[model samples]
Target: MRKLTDFEKQVIEQKGTERPYSGEYYQHDVKGVYCCKKCDAPLYRSESKFNAHCGWPAFDDEISGAVKRNIDADGRRVEIVCAECEGHLGHVFEGEFLTPKNVRHCVNSVSMVFKSALEVVAPVKKTELATFGGGCFWCTEAIFSTLEGVNSVVSGYAGGSATDANYRAVCSGMTSHAEVVHIEFDPDVISYESLLAVFWQSHDPTTLNRQGNDSGPQYRSVVFIHSDKQAESVNAMINTLTKACVWQDPIVTEVAAFDGFYPAEDYHNDYFELNGEQPYCKIVVKPKVDKVKALFAELLKSN
Candidate 1:
């Protein structure tokens, strides 16, 4: 609400370029929120973050759509700005930080604020993303978000062509979109493989283009891999399962890198979670939840 306190002042502005804690991007280190110091727009989460010698908060990634970047005033520099209010944040550099992407976003801490947590997670701040398609994003997103490590699961249409689509178009089986859930999770506690494993088990992958009675190309069994390694990993898992005779029939799941993911209409998100008491919720989602609990007993919370 107000300017940062004195200790905050030192961390944000007092550090020199070469000192140990001087250029330290992550001080609290475990888990915290990184927000715009100017407008308080929530920016980075601590999970995808790593320590960099960069003279500002160096993160491997940002909370999607919270902040944005454009070529800076220097024209050569890519300017990072608060997507909420266009407040100047900092610049992005490459070949400097080391991580999966080898990218660094050098954001001035003066441009950011931090939040402390009484809970393990400060719900007020996060930068999280996870995607899944469980036949009708409504059903898919509803099931996943109930589990731990899942922060936000948005229903969407992914791996599609250019243009807008709605329930009519998607249901028509012409949009080339798979119903998906963009999930955000705490990676430290759960690995991507675990999420993928949950995804594979959650829905009936044996069905060619449907879940339960739902049928159509829109309901097809597909896993959109976001990275090359993800493609290899998922493919390997499928191959291993095939070799082990997991499914009597070959897995017809489509494995491909994502070109794009388009979110479904607002009404679709949390359909099962909200409508759990409704007919579809009781008849459809509840039974599915039971199956997941039985199949994934190892993954279930002990409590």
Candidate 2:
């Protein structure tokens, strides 16, 4: 079982309520699954959340069989708890008409933990890895993380020597390393070509060593292929995009052989999701994320 902080114990064990509008997830708007803090059971989808002006994170739905509801001891409110562990999750209210469902799940922010679609690392019987650098790993991570078949998208450095893989060295633009994501995916659910498509469409391959205000060798566009088959698929997709006149400028994206990928520092792995309110995430990552969510809606995992 996951260890709980004092605040979590208060709200989850003692059935406490966090101050309105103070919860971390109260205003969160990212695509991913929310799970029980105590048991890690899947609870809610980002799509089901809406602002109810009630100071708590409001949801209109929960993942099937993930939650159980019962009347509170006072017999005035319905309390929702994690089905697997019976962890306290606040209360559910109905007939509010706040959303199309006409129901609201008033959940404490501390009651659950969010697993952004980009950070899910579910183990599968079969899986494959694809590595690509398309500017900032934070943006790239956000884009690919939502895809249906992707198991996990890890932000890291590649196409560079191991000694200089650290973020500070890469940021200096002296190392050959480029910020990249190592994606673990299931080919049966999403093909390599589809991932490549997202890679190309989500960023400007035309820019040589920069993406918007960010410019450096570390931000260059590159695809590091893991196998001959991956190389062929990437080539074919680039050819198709070229034939369709997707960009006015010639694509400068380099297709390189798979090299060692050094996972980024711990804090950088889910920078965008964990630090969404930061200026960089709010200003740069969110817009790109919104675009990816819209363009690849069908590929996103359903909550």
Candidate 3:
């Protein structure tokens, strides 16, 4: 029963922060049961663990004496308290397994030290967040809502003829508002260039003051780049599109230095999901969704 070194403890804590089940901690495959580091209460038998890739060690079930279950402070039903001395462990949930027991004991890897024989790598996270605006925040917003790796999509206005612009004046095409969406994405799963490709295909950037059918300066196409790399990637794609004559009229999409982005009112967020039956959604948004699903099904999350 040797004490863990400082680095080992740090490793555990660091792995805990990355993601619940996304680290190398769970790559272990040996014949030893995992137990509480604090009190050595057997939390899981090695045979029960499976390759979940959630960054945490996952098991089909835990040894009965090794843990306790209780209601958490959030009022959500949870499991915790190691049996030996009642050390606080994380919660347990049901229905994750596709197999028989139909449950997963999603334990924090760091909380209990693994006693496996083989070496295991820590899991890593490879997701990124980005904000973008094209034109007609409504149109751009609606278009990106359908892509893959897109955890969530939100519409808002950015870069303007005026600060603190609203949907009305921007719709008037006077406040110089172009539609936009903030996208949460996983970089390991999708690339920004692919998203750019979707952006170009989803809207008519060739139109200077509009995005086909939605005529107005507010609806103009633009790429509000978040960083130098994003700017370079966007510019490279624009160059390729220009050389290839992807747009008959000429690429009007501007790669402007992104100053700032403002989140739109709550109601404006996820307009397509919220107002699926609305007339604009049916006519404008639905077609975009259909096109994305047909052309970019590989990038979408499973329903």
Evaluated with TM-score, which candidate comes out highest? 3
Candidate 2 lDDT score relative to the true structure: 0.91
How close is every model to the real structure, measured as TM-score?
Answer: 0.56, 0.58, 0.59
Each prediction's number of clashing residue pairs: 6, 1, 16
lDDT of 2 by residue, 1-303 (tens): 799999899999899999998999989999999999998888999989999999999999999999999999899999999999999999999988878888999999999999999986776579999999999999999888878899999999998889889999999999989999999999988888878878887899989999998998889999999999999998888898888888998888989998799999998888888999999999889999888777676545441
Instruction: Single out the weakest 10-residue window by summed lDDT for candidate 2.
Output: 294-303
Candidate 1, 174-239: lDDT as tens digits: 778877777778766566777777778778777888888888888887877767767777888888
CA lDDT of each candidate? 0.71, 0.91, 0.70
Instruction: Write out the backbone clash pairs for model 1.
Output: 37-111, 37-112, 129-183, 130-182, 130-183, 132-181
Best by lDDT: 2
Off by over 4 Å in 2: 1-124, 298-303
Q: Residue 267 of candidate 2: its Cα lDDT?
A: 88
lDDT of 3 by residue, 1-303 (tens): 336556434533232233554544567777877877665556788878887666667777778766777776678757565767555556677866544788776676666777654433334766665665555566567677666677777777777744646777677777766667778788877788778878877877787876667777667777777789998898888889899987678878877777666677788887777788989889877887788667676545432
Candidate 1 vs candidate 3: the lDDT winner is 1
Ranking by TM-score: 3, 2, 1
Off by over 4 Å in 1: 1-128, 300-303
